[model samples]
Target: MTDQYAVLGNPVTHSRSPFIHACFARQQHQRMEYRAIEAPLDGFESCVSQFLQGDGKGVNVTVPFKEQAWRLAACRTPRAELAGAVNTLWRDESGQLWGDNTDGIGLVTDLTQNVQVKLEGARILMLGAGGAVRGVIQPLLDAGCSQLFIANRTAEKAQLLVEQFAPLLPEGVLLQGGGYTSVPSDGEFDLIINGTSASLSGDLPPVNPVIVGAHTLCYDMMYSARPTAFCQWAITHQAARAVDGLGMLVEQAAEAFLCWRGVRPDTAPVISLLRQSLA
Candidate 1:
């Protein structure tokens, strides 16, 4: 029988995961069936339990359910433990659930490999201190950025994140956090990553244009058919490049697929296909 997998989200119909995973299965010749599961807002645990009991091999958790899934897991990868959220889930031989968060590695891969942006020794600015931002901090630090600054509406939240991840910083790497208005003006950043949900509502973070220089790459962790507000803002500020999170989405899914199937599917073609579909 084909292995069964799915993506669980509250508003799951909008997820491109099933299609992306289908492409992976075909590329790797894996006998698998993937689908989108709309778990009720308060019914995530029960829904996941039912799926696993039905012989489901794995499922990608998203949005409000990631934290719940993290709590439900019998074991978690180091990254997932730091993130305090779980986006990928599967069962071990003993039927113990394992959880992992691929969002950070996905963002790092897309930026360094796909976009060819050098993260090492580069000054980076991350906007927002929510779960999306939390999931990526360790990986970004692991990438060897010389400086990483996080700015959020709630200054305390951003500070908390900085405190939480400070011990992981490598020598010579600086990590700071503050409110949007408190973003440093001493110098420009090489990269500015928008991890906020502002773009989903057509809003842009209150970052100063001075933070973006001609060589800065602005990345919004949100993708849409058209340019996102943050992308347009970056363009207007004359930044070097403004990219959406589509590549990150595909890359993260590829990582999850590898975890479940032990085969890494080539992501370039899948990214191209998804981009074309978006266009």
Candidate 2:
């Protein structure tokens, strides 16, 4: 039988993961079945356990279940440990369940490789302090970002991330967190990433244009056929580039594919195909 993989979440019907993975498997000539399984909010644990114990080879957890998946795993990679969540899971031959967070690496890979953004010595302003933001902080730091200031609606939540990630900061790198008003008056940024879901509702985060310069790249973690509100704002402010997270989504799935299949898929073609579909 072909190996099975899936993304498990509540409200998973909206996920593009199955289509993307199907593209990947086809492109690589691999025999695998990937799908999305919607588990009841309270039934994530049981659903995941049942899948892994039976015929499922691996699963990708999303949204509300990532934390629960993290807790349920018998072993976790360091990145997942720091993230306090898990987006990918598999069981080894010995039956030990393994968890990992590929979000950060996926984002970093997309920015550096696909978007051609420079991370070393770059000043970044990240909007949001939630789980999506948390999973990607360390990878950004590791990518040699000179400064990362996280802005959120609630200042304390942002500060907690700053304190928690302080130890992992590369020497001479600066990391700070605060409310929207606390964003530095510093002239402009090399990059600005919006991690909030405001775009799904056609709302833009309360960000000032002062943070975006002609050299800045504005990236929204949400993807749509039309420009997201945040991306529109960035373009209106004359930022160098305004893009969505479709590439990140494809790249992350590629990382998960590599984890389960032991071979990486070429993401450029998949990304192009996905963009065309969105259009």
Candidate 3:
């Protein structure tokens, strides 16, 4: 029998996980069935329980339910524990649930491997202190970035994020948080990542365009059928490259698949298919 997997979200019809996973299974010749599951907002736990009780092998959790999945898991990976969120779930032979957050590793891989952005000793500016940013911090720091600055619309929330991540700060690797205006103009950063929900609202953060230059890489954690607002803004401001989140999505899914099946699925072709579909 084919192993069963799915991605769960409240509003799940729009999810591309089913298509993405289908591509992975076909390419890897893995016998698996993947689907998108819509669970009621308040029924996330019960829905997951039901799935587990069936032939479910694993699940990809999204958005409003990530936190709840983190709480429901019997055990969690270090990254998931640090992120306070879970996006991947699996049940062991013992019927114990395991949670992990592959979002950070996915983003890092997309940036360094796909985009060829060098992270070692690079100054990074991240826009937003929410779950997305939180999920990616450790991987970014681990990639040997010299400094990680998080700027948010609400300065206090940004500051609190820095505090929460203080333990992960490596010696000589700085982590700072503040309002966008507080970002010093000492020099242009090598990489700038947008993790804010501003793109969802068709808005860019209130940051100075001067921060972007011809050599800066601008990345938005939002993907659209066309260029996202942040990507447009980055291009208008002369960023070296403006990338959306489609690659991150595919890479994260690959990581989740690896966690469940112990085989790394190739992601480049899947990303190409997604980009073409979007185009």
Candidate 4:
């Protein structure tokens, strides 16, 4: 029997997950169908329960539903536990649901493999302290960045993240957090990531433009057909590269596919196809 899978979110019609996963399934010769599911804002649990009861093999949870999925799972991977969010979910032979967060690995892979940005010894600045940022922190720290700074509008949220992840830092690495206005003025970062929702609203973070320099690489964890607000900000600041999250989205889907199918599909062509379609 062909497997059934889907991505669940509010306002999910705009999702590219179905297209991305279809490409993977086709490339890997897997017998599966992927679709988008828009769960009602307050009815996510009920919607997911119904889907699973109807023979759904797996599902990807997005936005506000990720934390709910984490709570719903019978078990979770270590990364998911650290993130306190779940993006991928599947059931075992015993019918127990398991959750995992593939966001961090996806972001790291896209930054190092796809974008060719060396994270080792790189000074990094990340915007936002929400679930998106939480999902990527441990992996970025593990990737060997020398210093990581997280800035958010509400300073306490960012500081909480710093406190939570500080113990995981490798020797010689530093992690700090504060309000956007508190971003250090002493030095520039090699990499800056916008994990905030600012791009969706076409608003830039209230950060100093000086944080971006000629050698800096800026990435927004949001993608669109046109340049994202953060991407435009990077360009305006003459940053070396301005990237949207298309690559990360595809890479994360590929990781989730691997988790479900035990096989990895090539992502470059899928990303290219999605890019062209977006255009």
Cα lDDT computed for each candidate against the true fold: 0.94, 0.93, 0.91, 0.94
Compared with the true structure, model 3 gives a TM-score of: 0.98
* CA lDDT for candidate 3: 0.91
lDDT of 4: 0.94
The true-versus-predicted C-alpha distance at residue 60 of model 4, in Å, is: 0.5
Residue pairs with backbone atoms closer than 3 Å in model 1 (clashes): none
Model 2 quality (TM-score):
0.98
lDDT of 2 by residue, 140-241 (tens): 999998999999988899999999999878999999999999999768989999998877777777887888898999999888899888999999999999
Off by over 4 Å in 4: none
lDDT of 4 by residue, 1-279 (tens): 678999999989989999999999999999999999999999998888888877699999997799999999999999999999999999888999999999999999999999999999999999999999999999999999999999998999999999999888889999999999889978789999999997777777898988888899999999999999899989988999999999999999999999999998999999999999999
Model 1: per-residue Cα lDDT over 27-127, one tens digit each = 98999999999999999999998998876999999988999999999999999999999999999889999999999999999999999999989999999
Give per-residue lDDT, candidate 2, residue 102.
94
Error of 1 at 92 (Å): 0.6
- Please list the residue runs of candidate 1 whose C-alpha ends up more than 4 Å from where it truly belongs after superposition: none
Per-residue error (Å), model 4, residue 56: 1.1
TM-score of 4: 0.98
Number of the candidate with higher TM-score, 2 or 4: 2
